[model samples]
Target: MINLNHLNYCYRSGVNVLHDITAEIEPGIHLLMGENGAGKTTLLHIMAGLRYPRTATECTIDDVSTSLRLPSVLSKVFLLTDDMVFPYPTIAEMERYHAPFYPNFDAALLAENLSEFGINPRDSINNFSLGTRKKAYLAYALALRTDILLLDEPANGLDIDSKTVLLRMLSRNITDNQTVIISTHTIWDFQNLFDGVLVLSQGRLVLAEKVWTIVKSLAFVNSLEPISNALYLTQNMGRFQAIVPNDGTLDTAIDYVLLYTALHSPQQSIITQTVKNAR
Candidate 1:
């Protein structure tokens, strides 16, 4: 289990990005959704012990505590991001040089993913495209079999075929023993993949709940008429979308994309408010 209590973090400029965050992330596939600069990446780094938080914070894995002073507790956590920092090495060289750090790293699994993605270990890291490099890192991260996995926009720049493969891997690769926390704007890509959802907004943990629980409460539907009366409304290119609030009762089913559309549309927003106020 990855646990955080009153976690606060910021940069050197004294800008508080995350404020009083807390969560208990366990062995399950979880989605972390936020727009750009939502403090998701910073939170991941703090959890991974790559950076220290300025204020009072406590992050632990089971009984093992995490602090910037010791990276030992971090081996159970695998952090995958676009910037691999491979240091001008070939893929084979990278594996030989860096794979030892993660005790649970599976060399065989790495080779298999590399082969599946058409990334040769003998190929130089510089020779690969951004997508290929990301794939390699993803492959390596998965093979680590860590207790906690943190992926930051792992789907970016991936080709259609690779994306399909990546999706397949996540859906099939994860088991009950591991917890995967994916931080990305591409929440739609997850669709029915994630077991749970966590949304960060306004430097705060806006929402956290099991997908089954939340999906059962809220509903996202293609309304025949403009539905601006709901709590949130978004617009599409031409069609207006909205989420029918249920207040946690099983009165409606939700489609997330439709909810986003209704909430994002300006005309829908106003129309929704007017309708609600009238009723």
Candidate 2:
């Protein structure tokens, strides 16, 4: 339900944030992964229709790309950042204000989520803890039932228990028609949460493929010397790990974490065209 073709973007200072990028997305959980200053959030902002590129990027949703900023488009796209202040409304007042904007907004669901988090709607947002406010925002965002939900660092600043709760709620509540996209640096938290992985390197699209396909194209090896034509390699606790071409000749399981480390090494970046085109 999303498409970005030949996208290019830069800041007014002429600092290039995103190079030419092309990507397509369907309805599922897509994990956007990148290091610091890798333009993951920038890409999310562009996709949310809040920020526009200086040049044409050819972004489309549901076969339509032009009308991105309209309320109709905004209604289907929800961007959740870390700066939610909850406005000046008490929980009750906030719901009343947002009720008309979201056609599918469910007050009962929001209440249930708040109850699960042990949050009281009568309390003022300023008085609530940071985690509590985040919980409230999460509940409200899910209640909106937007077709595309953009979450930037959704798992940050939450307790371990709350993170688990967030995961469970996401698993249970997200509908089939919805497409959830999360951009974060800590990939370990996902732990089988992603249907596909979108990897960005140096402001360019590096990889976009299903995790299972990644498992097949690359294999983890203990020594780089034994592998044939190693493209990416890394050292872990004195042991070497490498990403090797999977020609179906070796029957071994691919360790993704190890492969990712090798693929993202700064000294020797090796996101080959062959590997990127695997999808």
Candidate 3:
């Protein structure tokens, strides 16, 4: 498990990016949701030890302090940023040079992923388009089999088919021992894969709970008309989507987009209170 205790981070210009963020991320697929400039990338960097947090803060993966950036810790963690650049000309060269750092790197798995994504291993990475590069690097990241995998805006440049392939790869490859935290604005792309959800708003973590817990506390509904007693409501695709207190009745499918919208809307406090009361 990844344990974050009162984590705070500030840049050289003294602009605070993350504020008192504390969450125990268990071994599963967790969705990190936040708007632009909400510090999602910074939080991922801090967790991967690429960026340091303020003093008196604790960030650890399975009791190993990430701030130390020990080789042992580094080997177990992998961070795939949105704007990734490859040093090697080809994927094959990259594998030959960097795969050794990861003790559990799977070359066979990498080949499989590349084939699924229609990426040529021998082709120069620099020649590939943005979407192709993202696919190639994503294949490598998955094959690393790291204990902690952090991906930032992974689906940014993918087409519809590529997105489906990516989701299939993640669903099939993620092991129980691995903890994958994906920071993306496009929640609908991987809504079903989320075991837990973490929401960051204006540098603060406003919500951190398992998917099961959230569903139990609140019901996500779609109606032709607005819900009068909804904790949060919004119009979507000519229909009204709302979040109301669950009375242990029917099971409603989660509308992640609507849930995220509500969290950022003015009625956020009401929804938070309802969840808190249910908890």
Best by TM-score: 3
| Pairs that clash in candidate 2 | none
Worst 10 residues of 2 by lDDT: 267-276
- Residue-level lDDT tens digits of model 2 in 86-155: 6655676778886578777888888988887788877787877788788877877887788999999888
Give per-residue CA lDDT, model 3, range 149-174, as digits (tens): 99999999999999999999999999
Residue 271 alpha-carbon offset, candidate 3, angstroms: 2.0
Whichever of 1 and 3 has more TM-score, that candidate is 3
RMSD (CA, Å), each prediction: 5.1, 3.0, 1.4
Candidate 2 wrongly placed segments (more than 4 Å): 55-57, 220-230, 247-260, 266-278
Q: How many backbone clashes can be found in candidate 2?
A: 0
Candidate 3 or 2, higher lDDT: 3
Model 3: clashing residue pairs?
none
Instruction: Please give the lDDT score at residue 67 for candidate 1.
Output: 68
Question: Which stretches of model 1 miss by more than 4 angstroms?
Answer: 55-57, 68-72, 227-229, 246-279
lDDT of 3 at 31: 93
Order of models, best TM-score first: 3, 2, 1
